[model samples]
Target: MKIPHKAHVALVDGERFLFLRNDGQIFDPKLSKVEEPDLEATNFSAGVKHQDQGGQISGSTDLNELAHAAAAAEWLNAKALANAFDELVVVADPKTLGEMRRHYHKELEKRLVGEVDKALTHEPLEKIGEVLANA
Candidate 1:
């Protein structure tokens, strides 16, 4: 399917996110940054211990907490886009993508135009469009 012109694109991972707006150009579509949150500073550790069925003990990292934080960020981004854009594309790692799906608001879900289950947070800005196009 063709990506909508001037749609908002969100690149997200477990610990970082980038918001870009498509400029509606041809192969030379311009993407401008709208926001990048400091996800590294947001701790997802539970700092607690748990016992397994085998009586084994482990210091469990709170994956749920991480997912919640990531979902919240996505929600905020979606809310911001709701007013300015009619479509949104999300490119997220598999784990974060699941979290986003679980927490997406009805309004955001309605505006979703596309989704890519790949981690592109570390890719260069110039390559994002190419990646999305290929996906």
Candidate 2:
């Protein structure tokens, strides 16, 4: 499925997660698979990691299961939604990035409005603070 340029990708595997950039580019994940002992032993179906023996188990579900119904489970692609993000780029400082996104992104977007027409090309991302302040 094609995700929007604006949409963020997060590669989540159970308790762990990695964040990826959309960058309006298509990428193929060079995934590594693990072999499961038996298919009957599985609690979930089709994981993000490949399984040579019993097959992968999936996690990500659309609309949430209890949030929806059986028809939703039958229809939605769980694996793709769960193992999101084309590429997982490790950030040096996660706390800072989280703070920026949580505290600044929306305010920057809201403050910039129509003035950000040439934003991607002209404005240096480092200078976002200036643009946001200008608004």
Candidate 3:
């Protein structure tokens, strides 16, 4: 459960994300913030609706789904800045994690170290390390 020094860690949700770099102190690792993307209010619809063949109604896409996609895209951009990391850890809710997995570039996939499928985006920074370690 020991994270390597300078490993990249990302805590993410459907609407927000935080990137950090571990300082290598396993017992008391310091996570220096690298990037924190601003999240905007999700718009559910653009005033358009359509009926399916089954007479079901829906918008072009669910706003929540769109938000998750956006978050994943933002994460990809941030990861690209680092080009590649020694190791990469991702912590996110199950749904968001799936979204990220779907969008991961081949290079990023090779760099992935671990993934914690839980929503720890709102947890305290100190607690986050514990969760990741336990996972």
lDDT of 1 by residue, 1-135 (tens): 346668888888766778788875644546778877554323233211222433333423345445544555555555755575678888887766766676576777778888999888888877888777766
Tens-place lDDT digits, model 2, residues 1-135: 333343333322222223333344323222222211111212233222233444323533322211222222211123234543222221212322222222222323332112111122122333422332343
| Error in Å for residue 82 of model 2 | 22
Error of 1 at 46 (Å): 12
Q: How big is the positional error of residue 79 in model 1, measured in Å on the Cα after superposition?
A: 1.4
Ordering by lDDT: 3, 1, 2
- C-alpha root-mean-square deviation, candidate 2: 18.2
TM-score for all models, in order of appearance = 0.71, 0.20, 0.71
Write the residue-wise lDDT of candidate 3 on 59-92 in tens digits: 4334465465455545555666578566787878
Residue 39 lDDT (model 3):
58
lDDT of each: 0.66, 0.26, 0.67
Model 3 residue 85 lDDT score? 64
Candidate 2 stretches greater than 4 Å from native: 26-135
